[model samples]
Target: MSDYIDQTHLQIYNSNVWAYGNSKWLGYPILKYPCDLFLYQEILHEVQPDIIIECGTFNGGSAMFLCSILELIGKGKVLSIDIDPQPNLPTHERLSYLKASSTSMQALKAAREMITLEDTVLVILDSDHRKHHVLTELNLYYPLVTKGSYLIVEDTNINGHPVSPDFGPGPMEAVEDFLQSNTNFIIDEEKHKFLITFNPKGYLKRIK
Candidate 1:
């Protein structure tokens, strides 16, 4: 675990994630209600976006949690797409699960059909970690996101192994590819770059 996440009291929540779409069992088992929780709450309270698209719904934990925030805010929905929907089952009324490959144009089209808002705010990329795969996913989703909204790409590094690039190429490498053209979406290099001997990439904003 990185020092930042480790020292942040994430361990307080343990791994007991609520099925109420409030949150999930992701992150350290202890820091379940860490900063990420508050951040999501703020996003809900302030941005109040009507649509959220989250790719790579591993266990639906993260997706459900964010959706619950939207639910509490009185509106908004989450279109969480995953190639494999057999992970941890999620409970969310505002969540619409789509089982399809994130890299597929067909799948993207299907996801678009499920959205209720044209000006979507958030796009969380936690799907296939391969560089090419992340790049492909970015190309399609980035354009759909509203300007000033967030585009969070999770697991920038594989666990604690920053040097070990398990992703065929990686989301980090994919960022390099993306910068070739879409430079307007600048990386908050300090925030996104992992500091704990590992590089867990996180991104924000797809458009300017």
Candidate 2:
């Protein structure tokens, strides 16, 4: 088990250092594993969600990617939020940006207003990976995820999914904590079929 974990860690390190550090998703730097990107594509196709709420808007590459998928799906909107302003966010008819912390009450209120009761919402928490912050975000946004959709928590591979062992409690830990009391959501293992992803076990689907 230890040996396998070590090897996986090295692969994750290489993917982060080489692939994510040196690539772009649709002309925008996207610091995400390619496998994870594929997973997102698959999920978007399968869910055909009405709205996607991305908690972190790093460079807006991922938002652009989602918007492109929405275009292909012929509908949907991307509401991306970040604590800091991104000057060069990708332009898209389906994309909206909000510069605010994902867990802030004001931001949450605005997000709720954007979501209609009939909307099938998907949320991605990629900002502030600290356990507390992720937990707060989960509590704040999980409700937006209608039944049969997803609430994805990115970067769970860090802080010892064998990468960044000393990075402290992050997305993975937060997930463990949240799942204890949350029965409506479960880890969708099929989403990890790619075998190499930055968000292992982070694909949570709402079954209720």
lDDT of each: 0.64, 0.87
lDDT string, candidate 1, 1-208, tens digits: 6555654323322234522445434431211234555555775676677788878776666676787678778888888888886555666778788888887877778767766556556777877878788888888888766776767666555422343433357777776788778865866554433333122345555446
**The 10-residue segment with the lowest total lDDT in model 2:** 12-21
TM-score of 1: 0.72
Measured on C-alpha atoms, candidate 2 has an lDDT of 0.87
Residue 150 lDDT in model 2? 96
By TM-score, the best candidate is: 2
Give model 1 RMSD, 1 decimal: 5.7
lDDT of 2 by residue, 1-208 (tens): 6577558756766654656437777888878777788889899999999989999997898899899889998989998999995677788999999988898887888788888888889999999889999999998899889999999999898897868888899999999999999999999999867666788789999999
For each candidate, how many residue pairs have backbone atoms clashing (under 3 Å)?
A: 7, 0
Scored against the true structure, residue 118 in model 2 reaches a CA lDDT of 84
